[model samples]
Target: MINSTQVSYFILVAYFDTGALKYLYFMIVMSLYMLIVGANLLLIVVICLNRSLHEPMYLFLCSLFVNELYGSTGLFPFLLLQILSDIHTVSAPFCYLQIFCVHFYGSVQFFTLGVMSYDRYLAICHPLQYHIRMTSSKVAILTAFIWLYSVLATVVMMSLSVPLQRCGNTIEKVYCDNYSIVKLACSDTTVSNIFGLVYIFTVIFGLVILILYTYMRILKVCFSGSKQTRQKAVSTCTPHLASLLSFAFGSFFEIVQGRFNMSRVPIMFRIFLSLYWLTCQPLFTPVLYGLNMSKIRIISKILYLGRRM
Candidate 1:
């Protein structure tokens, strides 16, 4: 049996010949990558530099932006190189590393969003106690927990996959996927499969439920409250809901891409769908939170347009 040590490289089967169009593809992807980096960085800096934005919500946003940059950076540079190269293969070690990063990013994204929802619920539903409950130190502790938990869980999952007896080195995607790697293992992958399912249910589905439940509570408060309360909920929760839905849509397709057969679909469309999961949400979050939230907008204007807050 060919184990992971024997399998030095993995062929990414998603890429097809684009010939001269590769230059066009390269420019497009490079531009997208740059934009993701620029937008996320701008927001991160705005959140960091402004004393007014030192609140819990903005702090959480900074974490979100940083995670976006992390996730995209993990994928895009290598993706750009792969697009231009005639060969679309990655080393086994780097592939596993990419797997770690992508999974960590995803888990953290779900978690941070969940925490942000809880923050909002406190802000709107229990305004008086919000500050006391979610103090700066608490936010720091929570943020640390999110990153640490994701790392420890992902490390355990990777340990299971990396040493397995690999029977193949072909991953039919534009990037490394842990499930794909596990599928290549000649040895049993029952443990990995169970852990993956448990992780998804607890992290992905659990967060979705949390977000939904928090919104439900907020909505109930708004219905009986004054116009100002309703408006506040709309202003604050709209972006969060929009973010959750957009990311969910993208994530659904990604899960499908990994688990289901789509061989009949056109290759180009499949590739775009795969990349969409990582691209759309990163762009959406900065725009939604940065522009849609008035405080961020005012502060961003001050920094970028030389206005005073």
Candidate 2:
């Protein structure tokens, strides 16, 4: 149970001054939110309906899309409301729930990406073993483990955060982020900070390095294969690799910038980084998987034509 002080609600300070800017911000963010929700939901539905997309890679991608939808929703809707209205306050219980969902879903996504990297590694480097190793049952079990791990990790993090006192309940950002939430705590957060650093290194950084290494080995093996086989393999992987690079490198640089207290950087740069993390995950998740899937592309085209008609 969270202490009363720790459970205190927060009021986010909106950035807009003019009523016109507020309205514009509301419309833009609301539109983006709806787009993210609709696109991800559509992708999930299409993937489930199409038997051709039942492979482990598509399965992992679908899981990632779902996580992005949940992760973004945890904060976006409330923040959108705050942007439009003068009231930026959130209830204490709701705030903690938001924190839990954000962390849990985000971690699940990281794990799913790790799973995707391994799937690609097997498909590219060990084509003979891919079928045996990534059977439907094994994929299902791996996905289950990812979700369970995410839940356990979230429990530990949420428990650590529950003791902080939030007497002055004001946050600078548009959303309830971990750094901002931890900063307001009256209790000593030294242990939490240390734990966060450890978690970041072990889970986030370590997984990223492992993914890169696996991909490199896969690439080497792919290049050594017959030309036709190599071309086919590259076609299957190149898009996913590009998407991963955009996601990982962009996030890494932006996080380093923000963590180093580079907030004094241009407002446009700050907003770009904020929206990059906010929008790209949802936007690219569906697009990457959909593009890689010919069946999905045909279905999307049919849907678009129907809408137009």
Candidate 3:
């Protein structure tokens, strides 16, 4: 029986032999990490400084931007260091910590999006009651619930896996993932597998359904209303929908990579698919929201001009 203390570290075997391009890879990844941080932080700061943007929608956006930073922070620093270093290994505890952070990021993201969807639903479908229903206090509670719920879920999942006897010390992915680590266990993982699947379906599909239902109702209302209503719906909902689709696609690709045999695919493409959710969503979400939402755009422009002056 391999005890937890016996396993010092696990090897990460995701990077390819980019003999001469390692430097380029490091620089590219570093630049992307910087961009993700800078863009998300800028939006967060802008939202905080401008009291006009303190409504439920913007508050939810702030939560999302913060999660983007949180999620990327979990992976980017370690990834950059691994890209530069020859040996890609992470200590067991740090690996589990990474798993917690990454999964926590994912859970909070879905919950936050669900909350955003609910906010939109109330704002559009119940306009008269919107303000009263989604008060500042309520919004804060909901956001807090999202983070807390996610943390609890991740902790439960990690606890289920921590006691399993690990037979191997190698992870095949770029970062420590719960599923990847669980696969290393020598003991039977049927319970963990079942729990993970249940958790995935319950959380991912449930949120996806909630989002779709809200949009469908919104669409119905928009169609029955005036042209202005339709345009307003399109402008506001497009970013969220786009963001949803982006996250779904990235997540889908990741799931496929994990479940299917990827031996036939190009190594680089596999790498891209594996890191897509972490990389693209954080980088593009702020851009999408910042550009598409009129209030945010105006505020961003004002901040930019003020900085120049």
- In candidate 1, which residue pairs clash? none
lDDT of each residue in 60-171, candidate 2, tens digit only: 8788888888877876787677777767678777877877886686678778877788888888888899989999999999999999999998888878876676556776
Report residue 50 deviation for candidate 2 (angstroms): 1.9
Q: Judged by lDDT against the true structure, how good is candidate 1?
A: 0.90
Per-residue accuracy of model 3 over 1-309 as CA lDDT, tens digit each? 676668889999986577878899889999999999999999999899989999999999999999999999999999888888888899989999998998899888878878888888888889899999999999999999999999899999998998788888888888888878777788888888888889878877788789889989999989899898888888888888888788889888887887778888988898888898888989999999988887888988888999999
Root-mean-square deviation (CA) per prediction: 1.8, 2.9, 1.4
In model 2, the worst 10-residue window by lDDT is 1-10
Q: Which portions of model 2 show Cα errors greater than 4 Å?
A: 1-7, 302-309
By the lDDT metric, which is better: model 1 or model 3?
Answer: 1
Those runs of model 1 whose alpha carbons end farther than 4 Å from true positions after fitting are 307-309
Better of 1 and 2 by TM-score: 1
Clash totals in order: 0, 0, 0
Which candidate, 2 or 3, has the higher lDDT?
Answer: 3
- For all predicted structures, in order, the TM-scores are 0.96, 0.88, 0.96
Best-matching candidate per lDDT: 1
